[model samples]
Target chain A: MRIERNGAIAALHGHCRVEDAETLAALLWEGSVTTLDLSGCDSLHGAVVQAILAFQPSVVGSPGDEFLKQHLVPALARRATAD
Target chain B: MIDELLAQFLIEGREQALEAGADLAALQRGPADPARLDRCFRAVHTLKGSADLLGLTPMGRVLHAAEDVLGRLRGGQGEGGDFSVLLEVADQVERWLDDLDTVGVLPESASAASQALIARLAGDGAAPQVAAADDWDGASAFPGRAGVAIRYRPRADGYFAGDDPIAIIKAVPDLAQLRVSLAEPVADPALYDPFRCTLVIEALSTAALPAVETALRLVRDQVALATLRAAEAFAPAGVEVETARRTLRIDAARVDQLADLSDQLVVAKGGLIELAAQAERGGDGQALGQALRAKQAELDRLVAALHTTVGQARMTPLAPLLGRFPRLVREIAATLGKPAALEIEGGEVEVDKAVVDGLFEPLLHLLRNALDHGVERPEARTAAGKPAQALVRLSARTVGDQAVIEVVDDGAGVDPARVRDRAVARGLIDATSAEAMSDAALVDLIFLPGFSTAETVSSVSGRGVGMDAVRAAVTRLGGRVEIDSRPGLGTTVRLALPIRMVLAKLLVVESAGERFGLPLDGVAEIARVPADRIFPIRAGRAFVLRDEVVPLVDLAQALGAEAGPSSDRVVVAGVGGEPVGFAVDAVVERIDAVVRPMAGLLAGARGVSGSTLTADGSVMLVLDLAELLA
Candidate 1:
């Protein structure tokens, strides 16, 4: 588990390919995240992505992966587009 | 191929065209606000472009003629000429489109309707009497239509279900834009398996809701679809620009999650509070305890801020619900031959979005009852020394933590005797029961199931359901509805509801060794007294509190729980303006809990409103104050 905090915002930095969803859900439940970051690291467990979708925190810094940045980030937060 | 494009326009073009349809409604009502006229004109311009593109001569001709009429209205033609002709042309165009939907082409008789409507819309002066009630101001009037955002994902086993995301997107009609992204994480090429489909497809379209829903009907369960107000669509329509604020639509579940997180903070704070009490007695870590207390205070501020920000997201103005009323009442008045005009105020009052959504149906029932049953006819009103046009005032305001919405009308009020006679005539109650019931109780009989006062069963409000459904719906939302009327004066229905139902603070009390949550707002006091202090009253025990005599009942007996040994602790709950005390075994600590109504069989149980959990994971029932007291 890789976690970084800037005030109330939280970002999962570096590689995180394997994670139990409940652990992340518990952590997210403990501390609310207004803006979540998904950059530098690319691999995400399927359940983690489900959690992120359910949480609906704004995604930032998507490591130049155009498909991820365009589709997943925009899907996560409708307002987090380049516009 | 040209036919296919027309089919696409039939769906997508018509959806886009509805954006300007309200301007036509506004045009018929009175002088067209310049901006509103422009909106209507612009809509036709876009539709004409698409129709011409599809080589549909009939659609193009109608739209072009309508555009000319809108252009004249924009150039100060002064709202005097017939605008209903344009509305008819638009409706005919829609009918032609609907024909295309079913038969794959326009109807054969479309040419005649097109010719007649085009000539009238172009001011050939064959104007008929305008219906006059067709007034809608576009988005400015009731623009609560939010854009539906959808995300689609095909599961690994989606192949078994015959679901393919690409084929689904390709099949979608009126797709404005589309994007496909990988649902897979970054991995080595060796482990990449394309056969296991994992892609999230995101799309935005101006297509109507039902069309998109039909397109994705096969795999709707595999995706997320949410209605959102697109931020960019607010193109500064230029009315009330100073107070405009851009909005982002978040799902209600997300806001509820934030509230849950905030609730977790409260639960954690409860533990910290207990620790602080321990440290204060120990004295060894007094300095550390003070520092922790200060940090807890800081945490309290941050959590509170989190709470308020999330709360604001769930709130919406009451105007949209209120705005739709004038148009509705107008139609009903014309139908019933009553000259009733509706006046709405305090449209700016902000309430929880859920509250606003749930409010419309109940208010509709009451307003229909008022119009069909309460309001007197024009001649009847004149004879009674009242205005010919009955005035129905629908207003809203915030009173403390509750929202008070009243539907007040000046007309013939409800007669309790008549209601009683109707109840007996309808066999809803026996004559003996009617004799024994008070006037107020007889009036309340209108809310009983299958009870309606409309003697002749009017065409408008004569749906078989009664006000009982209204009361049941409101009670489900933890709200109270009240009715009051004088013999000849008028009837007023007042509804009081909490701002939101998710989170509430309750004074924890124990009855018969079981914990119950008493809403803190309803609890005026918690008193500890000797058992000898209790005195017998006519039907129940009486306790003196603050120099006022209060009726007391055993909380355990009221809830039908096992009666344990009665203790000295009593929780005083407010009933209207009077005080009533509920005797319990003990008053525990206060808690902020998520008060949710019970589910399944427990839901039908009386006196128990809902259930919430303590931090220790024990389930506790929250008592219904009104039900228990009654």
Candidate 2:
């Protein structure tokens, strides 16, 4: 798991498996106005996806994986807008 | 406040999680049931969603894995697999949930445990992969089986919506085939948008559309499922989802609140009756007094009806408690190396949830005792001309307002001679009385405290308790536990418990102008006999009622009140198979009253279970019949 901050947004990087879910949640919770970047990731576990869905952060980038981008990215973006 | 909400979540989530496991066990016992399976699936999904929304990462991971297992189960995989793993996972989630609620974080082992369970759910040898079958031409993966075809175009960024299309697709109860087509034209590898899913998916599934739609409920609009013409024409096993819901869950606090209010209403209504009586005596406004009497009657009827309604709401079917016995007996039998089979009867009997919950420990103790000492070794049983496998029967049925639960084991029965010898040796009973006791009385001595027949205290029943403890618990709940044994046949323990707590039928009796209420459930009969019928016995006084000898006691003396006139009325109460009579000054009318439980110092007082307000404003103490007789 990797966490990077750029001003108000905290961008998540690397493959976030079940083990990384808690840490990812902690970083997002601790930071304000955070956004998720899935462009550099390989796969996101259900927990990570849950974290994204719950946090509802703006997506500055998208993952290369078709399933992640088309399904997960839109799901996350809709929530971010709705919230 | 967050901690409290999390605590409530933990409690509800844990219950739902266990129910999910029970649902799977039901599925394993029957043919394919898409509806029941879906119900189980929904439970896990709700738990997972709640955990994620609450930012409970550890809980989310655990439930997500359980959800996956349910999905595969919906796919008709691991149909006959033991659901112990699911229960264990749910139990672990509860433990971690408790940790999270208390310490605001999960323990170190949470993630590892979740990962392990996830792997187990996914480790079912090979997950059946349905090959894409298009056009339904001459070749088909699932030749003759009828299936619905689904065209799924998930939201462009469904992953962000917390939608896992792949997981949903895998969850379809019965998947026959899958064909994926890219919705857009192919782009160069360098310019490919890997983050976006642009697939137009189509699938032929043996599962019903309702099952598929429910599985993809979050993305219901994305999936278009239809029955294949050929398969539908040949096979008519079209599964129609049944939304027949049986039970509605109500918070226990709410039910208790209603019952408590009804009880208070009953007490308050008594004050109104007293006012009406005063009005009648005053002889002013006779018409108003008549109207007050009519209104009081109506209020009494409504109050009684409301009390009954609240009591029914507090009642829950005994299925859940009985459902756990199969697994319990199996595990206990295995551990004890005893070949015992558990046979349950009348599990559909419903009773107060509090009563059922209170029964768990005592029933568990009896079951363990049956397995440990009651059930004999297979070889020993065969030699004794009995079946090799011992049978343990647990049954519950409502006998009037009481639930009579019995546990019977077909094993080596208790030896009365041994019990008599043990009682004498333990100084519980003198040798002379032990020698003079009948076989049944000797066996009854086993219920005495500090009694154990085990040569070496076994771990199962060696918890420094005995049948006496079981009896004590049952007595505390205003129930009776009776033990019966035949020297070589078997032992049967019957627990008869009241079904509710609201209204108790009491037979009011007076002692020195003070009234006492005796619960009518335990009263066998009220007898009036002349002085000639009474005979002097060694204990006190004895009377023969239809050839049965009953010992009698004076209610005034027993209650430590002032002595009253010689009473002719005898309120005979049941004490196991025997009847004991309490002579009171007068036998008043039988009426229903809301018995208030004794609290504070009175809680520990013997022979008084509760008290009820009389119509005359004074309190009438309800005697604990069993305790008084004991």
Candidate 3:
């Protein structure tokens, strides 16, 4: 789900598609877009990962940003599950 | 192949039979006149013949059934009970006709119903001979045929009904060497129905028109019978005087064209005088044109008088629109379960034939609104110290070129405050705006789209659309809508519509050389203010116009045009009496012409309504006052 200040809103099925991630990156940089909601997305592709890392979003451990944090820290969850 | 045409003929025959039956049913209550009965019998008989000619057994069977019943009624053999049955048959047939009208085909389902009706009428068997007595026997006799020519249009249904139309023509008494022409038949027999009544008879009869009309008794609506004296047609031919007064009947469009020609010729007479004066002064052609100009002016007067008489001949009474309403009121009263009576006055008021067609929908909506909202329920009315029955009055009259139709009802009136409250609730207007609104301004809010004051929505009223829709429809035709309401009394919705909507007078004003028109009524006043006389205030601007302080807005900036130098003066205007001043570059010419609307994207633009051409043949934009004020 994505909600923008300029009245455009989009809902994704599950994980953000690679094409959708690139489009969101372009829209976010336009600055007119004030709101962003990306929940339930699992896989973060390499290009999208690099784009997100380059333009750092103020990510908090909120339900809406949970999916983004999960993709951000893959190793911690991998070790916890092994113990 | 013929079956489809037969079906078509049958459908039309059924429709004609039903219309005649309805007319008969309406005429039955009024003065018992033989002419009305004759009209009824003729419509049914025409349908019957058309059905038979098309060999539409089922359709012929039904019309034949109706014809027998109506024939007996016309002959005074049976009681009025048969009229009720015939009306039902007419209703069923009319329904079938409507289906055919919409889809171009009648469903097979109605055949059984038609058969049932035919069986009932068939059981009656023989029809009594109807009385053929004339109402006004020998009343205005048409003189001899020396200068006269007549034309007859045989019933459109006559050919399909197997009626030998030529025989009907031969039946006309004293008919002289008549030229007959058959109207072309429909092509594509597979799609064409042999039963469909497509035949017409165009005849030039020397007989008198009224006498022929008397002979035409049954098929009057379906027939175009006219008698033109030869002199009338020759009048516009620019021939000799006596020859111009001889007989010939021309179409109405040609008459209007002649009027335009005469007006142009009158102007040409002025030019002729100027030329003749110059010719005489130059000592040239004095003997050639001694009284030519005088003769031309006299000829112009004679032509003008002839044009006036011809135009008057085309003026038909408002009877047709008036005639349909009593029955409409009866039907609507039955449907709504209310005892409402329609009192129509001044129905003799004549209007352009075109205006009558546009009048129906607006009048219908007004009547429906009166029934649904204005008229109170029986018990409620009696409890409120009012009469149990509601009176719905429809009156039409000519006030100049405009016709004013007043639909007045004796019921509860609309409350302006309630309308204001609704506007506030809908968020259509701000709280401060609502508070500042005048009663007239508040009353005008009822015409806003999606505004309804009814407590509960019914199929008839509320539904978030009512008077506003009527206002929009009326205004689209270049008319004005006014509402007068007295709480606890009644509401009268007055529609002042012009005889024709094609042309109007617009006051042209300019802002930065770009011309725009403020519909004359929307412009309250236009004044010139010296650069020192005008003063401006913060937040909202006001200027004195005819002793009243009216708020002003710069037109160029308001319309989002590039800003230019400010002017001290402005055009103060508003719709529905909300005063707002719009500053323009200059006040230009006032023009009268046909307004042509802009297409697509341009039509939706703010502050611009439509465009029209000036006398100099230049386009001027019509300003949208409401949008500018908003």
Candidate 4:
């Protein structure tokens, strides 16, 4: 995986559980997270969506779990790559 | 001081007289027996003596007149047609005594009313023939001569005023013997009117037939005279037989003292038994011989039985306690401006004297509460389509060695919803907790201190003291308070009190490495559990018994005792209906011990009722399970 540091861009990664997604969301709220990839992550459930809404209400994604990779991660990655 | 106690005794005495008089009045519907008539007179005589000591002069005079008239009736006085007046006199004396009981002194009005009743009886002018007629029995007992007897009954009103009927019988010439019989008034002192007399008299006279006729003729309106033939008077006679027939009357205090002394003797006998057992177990030849040779032990056994019999004879019915309620309800109704009827059943149930004495205040509170709060206003009842007059019923009965007193009222019942709202408003219960509670649980909250849902505070009730104090009073005696109410129907409060508190049974258990007793009523079951049966469901949580998850707290951890694990029973029980499981070091055998209340500072401690001395002389603390569970 190729990743950008503090500005939020990241390459594809493996699967993560719903609980891990929640932990990731909490970390993103603290401004330490920039971008992520989930090419192999699988166990993530609606809890990840809940964690996002709970921590960063303004953040959104397309309708399904795929939306997390297509929109959320890329959105962060673009911001990081530009930075 | 003796006089005051005597007055108190008289207060009860007049009541008994009235009850007896009522029986006589009922008997008047038929022929009356002379022995029963004599027994009735003694009851009145006792009333007179006690009343006199208390300086209740008017009441004393009333009873004296009654005693005289009843004497004539026993002497075979004229036809027993005039007993109605004697019953009426008893009714009046009971009323006066009742008045003295309530106001602490009889008012002047009572004396004057009594005088009027006596005057009415005197005007009926019953002859003073009791003593004269009794003379005939005495004279005829001598031989073949026929003797004349006279009887007298005063009027129902003022039977004591200026009427020395007994003195009159004494005045008859040539009288051989005289006896006055008085019967107790049948009126309940609570409902007695102070102007009635209940007396009958009989007199014996032996003179020429003309002389007997002439004496009867002098007070024809006041006395009834009859000629008793010699055979009727002398038929049954013998000194030893008469002595055997007589009952020896003794003081109640003496009987009580004998009973107390007997109890001590029994305890000593038990000690002797222990000593004998020790002698038998050990091959102690001298000790065993001494134990066998003790004749004093046999004497003690006989004395103990005698004392027991004397003590039992002192026991009267619970009627006296139940008797006070009718008058109480009457007074409460008048004060509350409500129409109410109090019905008491099983008044004849017998209870220990000490229990009856302690029951007064608790029963009073229950009755007052029912009257002041439980019953609704007349209009409320009318609107609800119930009887305008509400009914309050008190029933008491003995079950095994326990007495159950039920105070029930058919009136407005307690509303749990209102109680819940009040509790939330008062911050006693949070809204969520209140919502989660059942109606029964919510209603029970009323017994908590300072909890009331009363819309208004009246002098009679609703100042927020609530039933907490009442519950404390009952539990202090190791009794339970149970309340069941249905809105718009009625409420019943049942108090389950031990027949006597001297002896108690408790379950001994070791909690926190210390021996403690859990009252038997609170112990549900004791079960042994394996270590593997317990499992942690949460970080600091575990379940103890079957699948139903019980929050586990180590006895040592919860009570700050030494926590050393060993195989022991996981005692499972519910306090106040909440499931609780606590481990104990061991469950000692059940035992019977006298419940000794904890002393001074420890008396108020939670979860401990008192301490008891075990057979081995070790102190065991009695745990109050309800308080612990709460």
The 10 consecutive residues of candidate 3 chain B with the worst lDDT sum are: B129-138
For model 4, the stretches where C-alpha displacement exceeds 4 angstroms are A1-83, B1-317, B503-630
Docking quality class, candidate 3: incorrect
lDDT of 1 by residue, A11-62 (tens): 7765443244455555555556667777754555444555554444567766
Two-chain DockQ for each candidate model: 0.02, 0.07, 0.00, 0.00
lDDT of candidate 4 over B1-630, digit per residue (tens):
544355445545655565555445443433566545655665565566456546678877777667666655655675653554565566566666666668767777666545544544443433233322322232223234345555655544423354434344445667665433333432343333223344454555776434664554545545545443443322122100111111133457767777677777777678678776787678688866776557466666668777566655544466767776676577677778889999998887765554565565567667878988899999999999999898999998888977889999998888888889888898888999999998889988877755766787564444433576566556655566788998898999998876656546676777666888777766667777667777776664456555677755565555445775664566666766765666777776565556978899988887778897653345678877666545
Report every candidate's CA lDDT: 0.66, 0.67, 0.57, 0.60
Pairwise TM-score winner, candidates 2 and 4: 2
Give, for candidate 4 chain B, the lowest lDDT window spanning 10 residues.
Answer: B238-247
Task: List, residue by residue over B129-180, the lDDT tens digit for candidate 1.
Answer: 1111112122222133334444666666654455545556555665544544
Clashes of 2: 22
Evaluate candidate 4 by giving its C-alpha RMSD to the native, one decimal: 40.8
Highest DockQ scorer: 2
Decide which is better by lDDT, 2 or 4: 2
Candidate number of the best lDDT: 2
Candidate 1, RMSD to the unseen true structure: 26.0
TM-score of each: 0.37, 0.37, 0.38, 0.36
**Native-to-model Cα distance after best TM-score fit, residue B265 in candidate 3, in Å:** 10
lDDT of 2 by residue, B1-630 (tens): 445446545665666665564554444334577655655765666567557646677678867777766666666776554343455465566567678768877787677556655554555433211111112221132244455656666666765566655567656766665544455543443343333555555566767544665776766545544343343332122222222223344558767777776776777678677777877687568776687777677677768877666667778877766765676677668767888899999888988766775576578778878888888988999999999889999999989989999999988888888888888888999999788888988888877866877666553453334677677667646577888887568889999988875557788888778778889899999899667899999869989898988888888877777768886888898877678988888876676666888999899888999987653335779998678656
